[model samples]
Target: MEASTSERPAAAEGGVAPMVRFDRVTKRYGALTVLDDLQLDIAAGEKVAIIGPSGSGKTTVLRMLMTLERIDGGVIWVDGEPMTHMPGPGAAGSGSLVPASQRHLRQVRGKVGMVFQHFNLFPHMSALKNCMEAPVTVLGLSRKEARERGAELLSMVGLGDKLDHFPGQLSGGQQQRVAIARALAMRPKVMLFDEVTSALDPELVGEVLTVIRKLGAEHDLTMIMVTHQMGFAKEFADRVCFFYQGRIAETGAPAELFGNPENERTRQFLSAVLEAG
Candidate 1:
């Protein structure tokens, strides 16, 4: 059966606890190295913005955290549990030689929610149905319970009236909002946003951002966002990280990084993006 919100396990809470930690992670796709040895720690309820030029592995960070992409080396820990750990080939742990078990991955994935650039809503379903599908299927929620929960989530995202609308009937911004609601339905501990507003119309960006801003304030979610919206990054993030050449180039508070960047690469990047904006 699908786990109820009350029964769902959340990530670590309280002060100074590392909700998510990436320890010396590295990922490579053949000759192309996507992520270098990287280490990052996100405290409970912290909102972190990952800003970088295109191809700087911003999205990869989110994907890796979600376990959508496997790490080539090192480990990830969530809520004090190892995310990608298993016994070695000839070692004994968790009963068997499998490095990573599907069951473990499912548990890990359930705690992490990811919102993609394009709202990947099911074309055949209405907003309500789209939101309820995973809960009912993967989590074993009854359709009625899922419907109620889904409606509540849709309403929370300012789409309560649009539950019956299909993706084709909604604007890009509305669709993305629904996507956010769908991810929220999982009651995830960590929410990963990958250029969430990048695909929206310029005028439609604010609504999506407002919804996110509210989420940041209202929930104790560990959020790691990959975004190009410099203004939003400055206002929403507790700390801003600049990635260059598949590594973190600079990281600091919004004021320190945006007002007085220590890295020359970060300075150049902000200059280019500011000019473009």
Candidate 2:
């Protein structure tokens, strides 16, 4: 079930370079350590799943990548650029915090887009408008161009007919799909899904998963997801990283990790989750 190189659309194609790299990155909240010296590398167009217990820091990785949370230590590189360092005014001779300018931050941040668990759609706007707003406001796309791209994305998510529908008028599954389309409008280099289906009803979970599966199968977007859906994770993820106590316990091909786990923590966690599944 791996997608072929030829299957990638022009928009999805990219060099086989490391899109993101986390080198011994650690995050802390006050005195509490959330991520303990985590090291990870995500290649272009690769789909990776992060699985762990409730407090295992799964969402922290996504938030850090989105730059929503600053790393307490270590560095993160995006598309071969140093995100933690920026140029500052040269102190009398030479010494500065390399003032991380907001302009530089915006440039790196623009390459990543995220879909949260809650459908963070603008409730006041129609589905089409929700998707169009960012492109027009941030990317400076013309109204006509943004509308066209929004329509295409809505069609891609099977919501072309619901373009005029507000978030309140849509079902949980439909709203999630719209949120995804909105993210795609940004044409990001990396996409993050943080327990996106966790908020949906049991029956609606499959619909959102179906959209994600299709994304993995057809699109070349580099995706990093933190999900509890073991079945989908097993079948969809090219690689899976199991975390334990804020650290990566094990990482490998999904078949090897899920079918023949190596780490004891992963084995125990997989057994518990799969049994409940």
Candidate 3:
């Protein structure tokens, strides 16, 4: 079937087009469906947090956007352009949602950057080198320019003095900060954080969250975070989506959702989470 180009009206202030859209998107593994016809839209410069119980498929949303996992059905749009599929060779608006070619995927995927729960820094490379490698290699930036950018980002994450340190030498928070800098070096339009603070020690979580808060306050990037840090989500996100049974069961402004959730599932989930904390 030809992929539908229809999209929800721009929901941001001033009617700007959505930065990301998931239209009837589905993901399945064997007999289990991880994401079932999930539909979501994110406006440019918006901060969205995905939160739910363990099997609610919150992380899958970000993973699918990063192209780390393939969708079984439907389409995903980034910047109003087809992400999972490209326009076909012939007629206008005639393309289907076929498996995207590697070249096409690479071109579109560059618009996104993702930081994971575990610090995925190169253990052998110094923090500066780890931050510089991608910009120099994939982005084709000059070594000197990449280094400058890397140094600036590392410093922004409060790691200027640790530029020469390896991941092993740095604490969990510091290494995660380096990973954030590395992702930012690519200058992605959309940033995804998948449980970025999950692996950190209790005290260390604040440092990473502080950096993320600064980014949300200062930058115009569209940020999507999958996190269990309820307090951080309430404070940092403009909207919080509660996923249930592989679908977004409820979503609203942070205050509304956390303070007066409309969905029973959401209320129950929040109650349990709050009780656990």
lDDT string for model 1 (1-277, tens) is 1111111123445535588888677888888998898888888788999999999998999998888888787677777666776444554433222335777878877889989999889999999999999999999999999999999999999999999999999999999999999999988999999999999999999999999999998999989999999999999999999999999999999999999999999999999999999
The lowest-lDDT stretch of 10 consecutive residues in candidate 3 is 1-10
State the TM-score for model 1: 0.91
lDDT of 3 at 226: 98
Clashing pairs in 2: none
- Write out the backbone clash pairs for model 1: 2-139, 2-140
Number of colliding residue pairs in each model: 2, 0, 0
Model 2, 1-277: lDDT tens digits are 1111111111224545578888677888889899998888888888999999999999999999998888777667677665654434554223222424678889888899999999899999999999999999999999999999999999988998999999999999999999999999999989999999999999999888988888888889899999999988889999999988889999999999999999999999988987888
lDDT of 2 at 235: 94
Candidate 3 regions exceeding 4 Å error are 1-13, 95-97
lDDT value, residue 104 of candidate 2? 85
- Model 2 ranges off by over 4 Å: 1-15, 87-99
Taking the tens digit of each residue's C-alpha lDDT, what string does model 3 give over 122-202?
A: 999999999999999999999999999999999999999999999999999999999999999999999999999999999
Judged by lDDT against the true structure, how good is candidate 1?
Answer: 0.86
Candidate 2's TM-score reads 0.90
Q: Rank candidates, lDDT, best first.
A: 3, 1, 2
